[model samples]
Target: MTEIVGRLAPSPTGALHVGHARSFLLAWWHARSRGGRVVLRIEDLDRERVKPGATDLVLRDLEWLGLDWDGPMLRQSEDEEPLRAAVAELLERGSVYPCFCTRREIALSAPHVTDGEVRYPGTCRGRFASAADGERELGRAPGLRLAVEPGELALEDGFVGPFTSDVEREVGDFQVQRRDGALAYQLAVVVHDARQGVTEVLRGRDLLSSSARQWLLQEHLGLPHPTWYHVPVVVDEGGARLAKRRGDATLVELRERRVDPRALVAWVARSSGVNAPDRIGARDALEGFRLDAVPKEDVVFGARERAALG
Candidate 1:
């Protein structure tokens, strides 16, 4: 944590919403409060879902909100070559293997599970003797998985106090790369964070499980571990998390309705327990910034929030 590097990684698959802005603002505040720096990383690896001008819109929105980054923005797509190398290294280390189980097959195995989780039962953990064996057995390309050792990973979270997880049982050898050869988010994120010298990760609590998975990868890859703060997620009236894919209220739509950026930030500040003025910018909002001050529970967007944006 020497340099105190942080990042706002947004996948340019759709227009970003207020929830996205809240998380990004928190990240920017965390870094700037320490007189450190923030980096903007465009995670556009999911090609099919990536909109043509989504990246530009996201940058414009961030600028409009008055958040600044230290250097050039990084895009995940540009790191394809490095991702391939990392995959090769994992394969050679014997910690990675091909998992030929289809989504349907895996879903059936973990039938009792809910909440959109399809845990890997280690069905194909040892099915393929080697890469050669996997290649020969594959009628279709197989997804790659990392074998996990039985142990618990404990990491101190800044926002949420002491966190520990048994990644081995909770999550078996998870996918490192998809069957289509696209690198998994878990592996790609860990590699990029390490390469960029990131010392902290500030994102939503929905990805809390990811920390344990990424920690194992970091340990195996001999990379430095960054402190994590999984801030509470933004949920809708129904208590379901807001998602870009769900066509949630985006910044573009709100802007069109004449909603000011300051209004949005002020709402976020109050919602996250940051005492602030009626209107404020990112820098000004820092006056009340405190990691511990942020609420531990999720923020619900109801009728009041809808009227504020609309």
Candidate 2:
């Protein structure tokens, strides 16, 4: 049997909330079921937003949740050289181009719509220019953008099934490197996953659209594409999705409140209706749990649900 490798790549920008716990649980379960290795990767490339001690909080949370991962934890910040190398290779091959347009310029100059994010309009595609032959010493600070070809990028999601996205229609040419000298999420994630041999990706359905773009980048970089599984996202009573920045109910908070780890695990399982709320421990709950049994609908995390867990 082929080794099944899965990963939980979380940004160390805040505490790991319940939604993040669900994502990690799913990834861990998938890897354990297959007797595969689970990698813990810290996606802290956003230097400006990453808070001090956030990484330690993440590690403590995972350990508190009774999760163990193989190998030393990987940090994206330590892998910037390789990421830049990948960007440079793509630029030299004409697969990527330099973008000088700022976000404000693109927003004002293009017919962009807010599809939960600021969509880019291929405003700089025609204006893109290659580096001069003798300008090899121009350094790695150039803002590079991946040219999304005019075609439908498709992927077979493990849970969501068939998914496709017209990159030009949905999101125009996106950035691989920002003008501020930071690596973009889409580019960095693909590089890290490929380099680490991640065979499966388990994330929230909210990221399904972005997965299409990553698939495009994977092809351009000739990297091995991993199977994707997008789990349902946890929402609040108002149907608003939980966010790390929005003061959502976090695992650390619940732990501080003396909520049993097993109970929290059971809550996650119950949210998907994979197991009853009476499930006692992680091993039992996970043993009876089936990935196919998880509901595709959004799981609401209201006040009543919190009270029930306690």
Candidate 3:
């Protein structure tokens, strides 16, 4: 049997918060309790939005919560060759094409499928013979988009069970590379997981929609698919999701106030249906940890709960 390997990937865009703690702790517990290896990956590819000190804070937060990993930390920006190589294969196979459509052009051409996402109308599909041709014709560098065919893709989530999404209808052909010559998140994540030999991907529920796209990339790239567990996200009392940019119940603030990390851990344990003491370390909560015990609904982290932790 293959060894189960899970990851605790943190994007260095903001300080870690209570919501982050819940997800990270659960990931750590789920992996460690089953004698699986936990890999810590720092997803810092979005350089424009990466906070200067956010990585350091992320490391500190994980340590404070007693979460540990089996190998050296993986930084996404340290290498780009693999990402470039993946794009090259797709381009060679004609699985992806150059897109010169701007945001305004796509918006004007296609209707909005979700709040901010537009179902790309394939405006630039086969519009150019080559990337240079698109640049020459449009007078602008083009991004690379995966050519998605019309069909409904289905995936079984370890937690959410069976799920289906029509990628071609809902998202159309999604970008694999940005117009500015940067790798897209979907491409980067698929390559990273495959290269790292990740077996299980346990993350927040908000990213559930992304699984289908990642699965598509994996299939096209001939990579193995990891078992997915999209657990509930932490939201406010009013059911609004927590935002890192808004500094919602950040761990940094709680630490500055000398809040006990174990208290927060214990809260998370109890929230997940584990009977934990008022203060318990992450490792202590791992003895009988069960992913099935975690609540399916979003965990709330409001002012009252924030005050209790602080």
Candidate 4:
């Protein structure tokens, strides 16, 4: 039997909001049910946006929720060297190249495409040959990008059923390392997941688009792709997605309002249509939790739901 491993990777930019709490709970419950290990990883590679003491806040929030992780928690900033090595291997195999095109250049070059993101135009694909000197300068400026071939990338999502996306058409060639000499999210997540022996991925549906890029990198790096489960995202009253930046529905706010942790868990379960809001105790909630019971429709949080738990 294959080992079932899962992780809860939260960026230390702000307090973990209710949406984050739901996602973390799903990851923890899934791993606990399978008797697998749950790893807590801090995705703080975006140094420019990371907040001071945010990591501590995340740890505190998880502890407040009564979630325990095995082993020492991992940080993306500490694993840059390994990701650099993985990028080097891909470059050696002619699977990646240096991209010098700016975001403005790509947008101006392709006006018909309206995905909002600038899909790389492959400006540096054949511009430079892989040189030994170039490999030594991996950490320097002018980031590297994976050359995505034209094809349909498909995967079976545990909750969402079968999903497919065309990489070259949707995302184009994506970055492994940013032009500012930072490791890209796609690159770091792929390498980290493989290194940690993660057999399953439980994240929110907001990241569904990114799974295609991750699958592409996993195939290029010769790493095994894990099964995916994109849980429904919690939204605000206006139907907008809840974010840590918004400061609305954050765990910190809930705690200030005198909300209990178990009640919060029950609230999340009830809001997502997984359990009753009146439910008490962790074991009762966990036993009542069902991945299939999660509603496919987006759940909007309001004062009434918050009152239901309190």
Question: Could you say which candidate leads in lDDT?
Answer: 3
For candidate 3, report its TM-score: 0.98
lDDT at residue 131 of model 2 (Cα atoms): 42
Compute each candidate's TM-score over C-alphas.
0.94, 0.93, 0.98, 0.91
Q: Pairs clashing in candidate 1?
A: none
What's the CA RMSD for each of the models?
1.8, 2.8, 1.1, 2.9
> How well is each residue in 46-128 modelled by candidate 4, as lDDT tens digits?
99889999999889889878888888888999878889899889978988777766667678876646255666667767765
Which portions of model 2 show Cα errors greater than 4 Å? 128-142, 276-279
Instruction: Give candidate 1's total backbone clashes.
Output: 0
- Estimate the TM-score for candidate 1: 0.94
Which ten-residue region of model 1 has the weakest summed lDDT? 110-119
lDDT tens digits, residue span 1-310, model 2: 7789999898999888888888888788877766789888999999988989999999988887778888888899998988988888887788887776667777777765746565677655655244432134444344777887788866699999997888877878888889887889999999999888899999988888888888888988899889999989889999998998987998878888988887778887676556555545555565666788888888888899888878
Return the candidate ranking by TM-score, descending.
Answer: 3, 1, 2, 4
> Candidate 2, 9: how far from true, in Å?
0.8
Query: Judged by TM-score relative to the true structure, which candidate is superior, 1 or 4?
Result: 1
* Worst ten in a row by lDDT for model 4: 131-140
Looking at model 2, report the run of 10 residues with the lowest lDDT sum.
132-141
Q: Point to the candidate with the largest TM-score.
A: 3
